[model samples]
Target: MSFVRTLRQATAADHEMVDAHYGGFALDRQADYRSFLTAHARALPAVERALAEASDLPPWRSRTALLAADLHALDAPIPAPLPFQPGAAAERWGALYVIEGSRLGGQLLARSVPAGLPSAYLAAHHLPGEWRRLLTTLDTHAAGQGQAWQDAALAGARACFALYARAAAIA
Candidate 1:
């Protein structure tokens, strides 16, 4: 199935969706996020495929930061300035999705933990602590306003990579 190309085109309605998706501590979009993920998770491979059409992770990373730009466009006060063109904020979200997908897929880090046992057992037990760390980082950023959403997104993605790396080492 094809992922929504409108995510790339980023229409006005898309901006509303991005804002709604990240509703966090202040805005409380967490429930929406959960619902969205549950509804969209199965379709993410199409997004990944579309992202792969891009040259590298940075483009996706930039996409994840699209919210900041949108907020700015909408005159929403962010703690910092946005690093991308207006209407392109969802790029950051897309990037975050790509980063997590890579980690989950074990392309960069094994999706298992080794307790001096067989690899199969390791794969069965995902490290909650690692997942927590990644989620916390994401939630932390998702909760607040920022100027450089791209930078923040990159930082969050890096944290996820580190978490996965640690898990892979243990596996």
Candidate 2:
């Protein structure tokens, strides 16, 4: 399939996976609602960079704004450390919604200087190979065949699922 088409496919899949991650924890724990987002304090930049680097947008100003709005939906307090119980479906889905929206906006307005991804994705966090694989796919799509975003987004979205699954070690 065309890479652009692949990116959109990845976006749909991205939405679904985010939903699933929230769903999994939502069933038993209320704490999980916020736990997912706690990391976003750092990850949001990653997301923004993913979009910004791709679209050449400025770094996220008020990165916490998106996260805070999502947190408001939950009844539970912000999560603490490990041993957190993922929250109810309502909670998990809310966070996922935030991610989708942020990603969507980033994808929409994004205009990167270069066709390829910035160094952070592979370096800083050094996402697992699975994640890197998708980034690489985006890289290929970005650098390849006229340079595209739609294709990169979908591919990146699909890759995000694998990362989430890997983190959870879900079969």
Candidate 3:
């Protein structure tokens, strides 16, 4: 099995826990949707900023900006700025793994959004081969890891999921 697969299995419980906190696709009101976007806005920029600071990775478009646009279109206030400290390079990759993987699900979530609502964040701008690139990068990062590096990366990914859970509470 590839390291990405291993990482997925290792983090499976955390993934399920985070998903449980997000009120699902059955939202009946625009208010619920706005709250959901606002919660995402609160959490994503921090993770993105940390990734930016720690790695020389080429830019993938910022979902924070996309979320802000959707929030504005919905008349929801943008979330206030939050401080996010950068992590080590390996840790940043781990956190990024969660963020980037969400784009795949965002494609599905975008389908369920009400017709009249803005869905730019879910309708992420496509970059050909982005997921494959990120997966290859992650696999390479994991290739030579010692237990300590693996631990740090797992912790970073878990921290990201926990951050979203906290944001979900506020939403």
Q: How many residue pairs clash in each candidate?
A: 15, 16, 0
Off by over 4 Å in 2: 1-6, 27-30, 49-55, 58-62, 65-153, 160-171
Task: Give one digit per residue, the lDDT tens place, for model 2 in 77-153.
Answer: 33322221222222222222234444443333223212332212112221235333544544453454443344333
**Number of the top-ranking candidate, with lDDT as the measure:** 3
Let me know the TM-score candidate 2 reaches against the reference structure: 0.36
Cα lDDT tens digits for candidate 1, 1-171: 112232223333433343343232121243332232222222233344444554433322222233233333334433321122212343445445434444443321222222321122112222456544545554454446354654444433333333323322221
RMSD of each: 18.9, 14.9, 1.8
lDDT of each: 0.34, 0.38, 0.79
Off by over 4 Å in 3: 24-28, 81-83
Q: Which wins on lDDT, candidate 1 or candidate 3?
A: 3
- On a 0 to 100 scale, what is the lDDT of residue 23 in model 1? 33
Question: How far does residue 94 in candidate 2 sit from its true spot (Å)?
Answer: 21
Per-prediction TM-score, please?
0.22, 0.36, 0.91
- Residues 32-126 of candidate 3: C-alpha lDDT, one tens digit per residue: 88888888888898888787676445456678888989999998899864555546566776788889888887887888788889998988945
